[model samples]
Target chain A: MLQIENVYKTFNPGTINEKKALRGINLTLNPGDFVTVIGGNGAGKSTLLNMITGVYSVDSGKIIIDGVDVTKMPDYKRAKYFGRVFQDPMMGTAADMQIEENLALALRRGKKPTLRPGITAKERIRFKELLSMLDLGLEDRLTSKVGLLSGGQRQAITLLMATLENPKLLMLDEHTAALDPQTAAKVLSITDKLVTSGNITTLMITHNMRDAIHYGNRLIMMNNGEIVFDVSGEEKKSLTVDGLIKKFSETSKGMLSDRTLLSD
Target chain B: MIEFIQSLPSPIAQGMIWGLMAIGVYITYKILDFADLTVDGSLGTGGAVLVVLTTQFNVNIYLALVAAFAAGCLAGFVTGILHTKFGIPAILSGILTQLALYSINLGIMSGRANTTISWRNYKLIVSSKTDELFFTILKLIVIVGAIIAVLYWFFGTEIGRSIRATGCNQNMSRANGINTDTTKIIGLVISNGIVAVSGGLLSQFSGSADVNMGRGAIVIGLAAVIIGEVVFGKLFNNFVLRLMSVVFGGIIYYIVIALVLKLGLNSNNLKLFSAAFVAVFLAIPYWKTKMAVKQPASKDKKTVSQKEVKGNAAN
Candidate 1:
């Protein structure tokens, strides 16, 4: 479970360039809840995730993971409780390291690193087994540097890495947004399978209304640094792209300048 | 011609010693993705510590080298603290540490800029004054062999792999639970430690530790790393071989310098030549990309850092 308690963040406070990024946001997720977050620009969707992940300390709030308050914890310190895939595929995996090496690092998440061989003979076999599941032929390229892989392949590997240790919460920030349409769909399918198979507590952020509608059990719409609409269960499943866009427009007073939010 | 051939042994031995410093630089520059200027100070620190310990304290020569390495590690730790704990930039932190070490090196030499240890009074590892130049060269090769072997193994370990990950992709390392700041500090410590050891050895070989002995060391170190990459990048895919290439680069650099001197180039202009040499090699890759008739596959990789920029724009 994850808890966010009335979080607020204001960037460049008291300056002429000041902008309120997050405004007293509060949310809670039960175990195995796969939540998809949709919002227009400046909705503070990524800020909310960053707060939970401790990327930036919340100005005033508490973040609890698995019943432990981690609001004051540094980003790397609380990394044990969560796995994150950034909007950039390159952000999730080291570019120059080999495929198996990256997986080995993920396999030891939350554990004190030791002087043991980074990639053991046994772990190599396990990594191959895990890689084969992606159906991307990465199992055959265990020694290949991740930089050499295609964007979609890198994103697929990053997905596997985030879920490698069955993290308490998985955060995906538009992980497939950079890929081509076909590749994005494939990665999204992989994301759906992994989240359901592991029953991971996930909070995903996306701009595409269809993906926002198609994936995850719960949907929350954010605008102006606050969650404007929250829907889940039968209500979410019954909603279509058009219906969701209609709701989004009404929440923002029908001033929809960016139509691409629903174009996909 | 005979004179030039005979003079070759001294620089060859000198090259092997400087090669150790090159490996240390490789760790910081190539592996950690940090341009550490700390070696300029730490190398002198090592030399000062070694000479003072051996000549004044009457310690064993080998033990003195260990003391020098410790001194170097302490210098590197100061730089690490400045960078990681105090929030200073990596390059500035190194410059500060290097600047401080000049006074410390003087202090270690009992307020003297140079300290000499006579080969006749105490045993030395490798000295040009002795007629055992060939054996000295052999001993240095063995030493370099052992150094690379240990480094190769260390880099393959989990903690060491994390350091490499920190260098290549800090965000990914942190997501996997690695504390990158700690890793960067560890790298600086290891790198400067080795540089100090090389300095200690060079001081023994040449008979004195000078405050300016390590001047422009980072440039030479960079020169060696670039030369190694240019000469052996394709041939050595294995980790151990890659390290050896760096040492080989050092040897080649020294030999070229010696050969040029023999061919009538002014020794005073060597520093300028070295600076120009590194600049040209650094530009070669870019030139190759521009001159290629067909663009390479490596060009297709759209740099992935743009994702962070987009993430910022979205928020």
Candidate 2:
């Protein structure tokens, strides 16, 4: 479970470039909750995720995860409780490291890292089994440089890496936004499988309204730094992209930009 | 040829010193993706500290060397803090550290600019005609071997992987729970420590320590790294081999310098020759990569098909 209370973040406060990225925001998620977040440009979606992940400290807020307050934690410390997949495929992995080595790192998250030989036979077997689940045949290329992987394959591997330890929370920040449509679909399916099988709590931010509707047990729409629409369970299941846009218009007239409503 | 063989000790010794500096430079420039100019000053800082500690303070020579190594690590840590904590760009942080070290190096030398270790009591150089050959080879083997071993062991550990990962991708390393800021500090500290060792050895070999001895060292080290990477890039996969290649690169670089001097060139023009050598060697890999890119894949149709098979393996 996660909680955000009265969160406020302002970038470059008091300067000419000052912008209030998050304003008096409050959110909560139960265990096993998979929440899809919909927002437009400058909607503070990424900022919200960044604050939750401790990439940026909130100006005024308290963030609690699984009963532990982590708003003041550094990125490295906060990483122990959450797995993240960035929008850029190249941003989530060391390109020069081998596939198995990358997974080894992921598997050791929140645990004491040892200086023992790179990988043991048992660890290697476990890695192969996990890689096989991606259905990308990455298990066969365990020693291959991750740099040579296609975007889709790397993101799939990254998704698997994020969930390997089944952290308290998982955050996906438009993780498939950079991939082609077909590959994105494949990765999205993998994401679904990962969340469902592990029953992990997740907060996914996306620009694609269809995907926002298609997945997750809950949906929340963010605009101007606050969550304006929160729908869940059967309410979320019956919502269509058009109906969501209508709701956005009703909640905040003329605030729903045309570009956002039509974005894939 | 006999005379050249007899004179070989000087160049070989110089090569080892340059090799150590090159490895230091490689750690920052290659491994940490940092342009660290601190080596120019810290290298001399190492020599100055050792000289002052041993000769003026009457400290033991080995203790002097350890002190010099610690001084170098301190300099590196300062640079790391400036860059990571203060958010200064790496280049500027290195420059700031380099400037600070100039005054420190001067203070260590008592503003004398240079000092000799006075071989009156110490037989540091092993210069007897009978012992020269054996001693030179012994020194080369031991110094190069020790450096290679340390680099190998350091890079094979979990901390080493985290350091390498920080170099490749700092953000991802942080996301994986590796503190990249701390890793950068440790990497640079170790890098400069080895550089100081080289300085300590140089002081012993040359029988003197000069504050100006480290001049143009950054360029020289960069030259050595680029040359080694170009020549041995395909020859090795292990990090140890890569580090050793820089030592060998130092030797090759000095040999080229010696050959140029042999062909009716003045030693005074050595800096120019060093600069030219570096420029040419640095361009070799870039040009080679360009040529490879320009060449059609059809030239190696069989290999092309094999690569396609590998691509298919991913699917």
Candidate 3:
């Protein structure tokens, strides 16, 4: 479970470009809760994720992850508790490393990293089994450099690596936006399967409204640095893309915009 | 040819001395993804510190070397802090540190532009053998052995992998809970610390420390790193090979330069030669890829190749 209480983040305070990214925002997720977050550009969705991951300090607030207060922790310290998949697939993994090597690194998170005789047989076997689960045939290419993988394949590997240890929280920030539609769809299916099977507590930020409804047990909408709509259970079950767009316009004081609705 | 063969051991020793600095450069340049130029200044600064502490202050010679390492670490820390905390570019941060050390080094040398070892100063190699070359070779073996062993041990620890991971992908490193900024600082500190120690050794080897002795050191270090990487990259993926390759690169560089000098090449053109060597080593892969691309269009399979040759050369 994770809790964000009275969180505030302001960038470049007192400067000409000053922007209050998060304004007293509060949200909480119970264990195994898969929450999809939807917002337009600059709606403070990514900023909220960055704050949780400790990329930027909150102006004022506390972030509690699985009973551990992580508001003041540095990014690296917070990483052990959460797995993240970035928008750009390349950003999620080290390109110069082999497929197995990247997995080894992920496996060693929060532990002392050492270089011995390279990858041991036991580690290789475990890595192969994990890679096999992706069903991407990556098991056969353990020595292949990650740079040689396609964006979709790399993201799949990244997703597996992120979830290999089953961290307290899994954060996906438009993880498939860069892929072709078919590849994105495949990755999303993999994402759906992984999260549901592990029952991992996940916060997925997506630009697609349909995807917001398609995946996750709950959904939240944001506008102007605050959560304007938080729907779940039966309320979320009956929600449609049209109904959500209409609500955005009625409660958020703005049209949903063609791109926002079309993106769904 | 006999005389050339006789002079080979000295070059080997010089190579080992330069190898220490080159490995330091490799840490920052290859691993940390930083363009740190602090080696140019910190090397001389470290040498000056070692010389003054040992000769003037009458400090223990071994302790002076440790002091030199600490000074280098401090210099690298300054550069790292400037870049990470103040948002300065890595290159500019290094330049700033290098510029600041010029005066510090001079101050260490008692305002003299250079300092020569006094008669009573402890020598690093104290054999009574009349052959300077034999003594130098003996010193080289000891120093190189010490360097390789220490580096191998240091980089084998958990912290070393973290430093390497930080270099490979800083963002991922942070996401994985490695404080990339701290790692960057540590990597540079370790790197420059070794560089400074090498300078300390070099001062003893030359029996003098000049304020400007560290000029073009970055280029030379880079030359050694790239050449070692290119030549011996295929031998092994272990960190040990990486270190050995750096030493070999330095040796090759010195030998080539010596040969050039023997062929009536001007010493002043050393920088140009160094630059050219780095460019060629760096360009080897691109040229190979270009050649591969230009291959007859019959196959038209322009997929990204999984060739080690392609990747290593590109790097």
Best by the TM-score measure: 1
| TM-score between candidate 2 chain A and the true chain A | 0.97
In candidate 1, stretches whose alpha carbon ends up further than 4 angstroms from where it belongs are B1-3, B292-315
Per-residue accuracy of model 2 over B1-315 as CA lDDT, tens digit each? 677666666676677678878999999998888888889888888888887888888888778878988989998999999999999999899889888888888888988888888566664532223446467557766866887787777766777777888898888888888888888998889888777777776776666778887788888899888878888878966788888888878877877777678777898988988888888888887897888867784478678667556543432
Which pairs, if any, clash in model 2? none
State the TM-score of the second chain for every model.
Answer: 0.92, 0.89, 0.89
Show the colliding residue pairs in model 1. Answer: none
1 against 3, candidate with superior TM-score: 1
lDDT of 2 by residue, A1-112 (tens): 8999999999999899999999999999999999999877887899999999999998998999889999898988789898999999999988988888788777767654
Tell how far residue A60 is off in model 1, in angstroms. 0.5
Candidate 3 stretches with Cα past 4 Å from truth are A8-20, A60-62, A67-69, A108-125, A140-144, A242-254, A258-261, B1-6, B53-67, B118-123, B126-135, B138-142, B234-237, B276-315
RMSD of each: 3.1, 4.3, 5.3
Error of 2 at B125 (Å): 6.6
TM-score of each: 0.96, 0.91, 0.85
Q: State model 3's lDDT.
A: 0.84
Q: lDDT tens string, model 1, B1-315?
A: 788778888888888788889999999888899999999999999999999999999999989999998999898899999999999999999999999999989988989988998788888888887487888898898888888988888999988999999899988888888998899999999999999999999999989999999999998888888888999999987888888888878888898898888788898999999999999999998898876735564354334445545533443
DockQ of each: 0.55, 0.36, 0.34
lDDT of the structure predicted as candidate 2: 0.83
Once model 3 is optimally superposed onto the true structure by TM-score, how far is the C-alpha of residue B45 displaced, in angstroms? 3.1
Please rank every candidate by lDDT, starting with the best.
Answer: 1, 3, 2
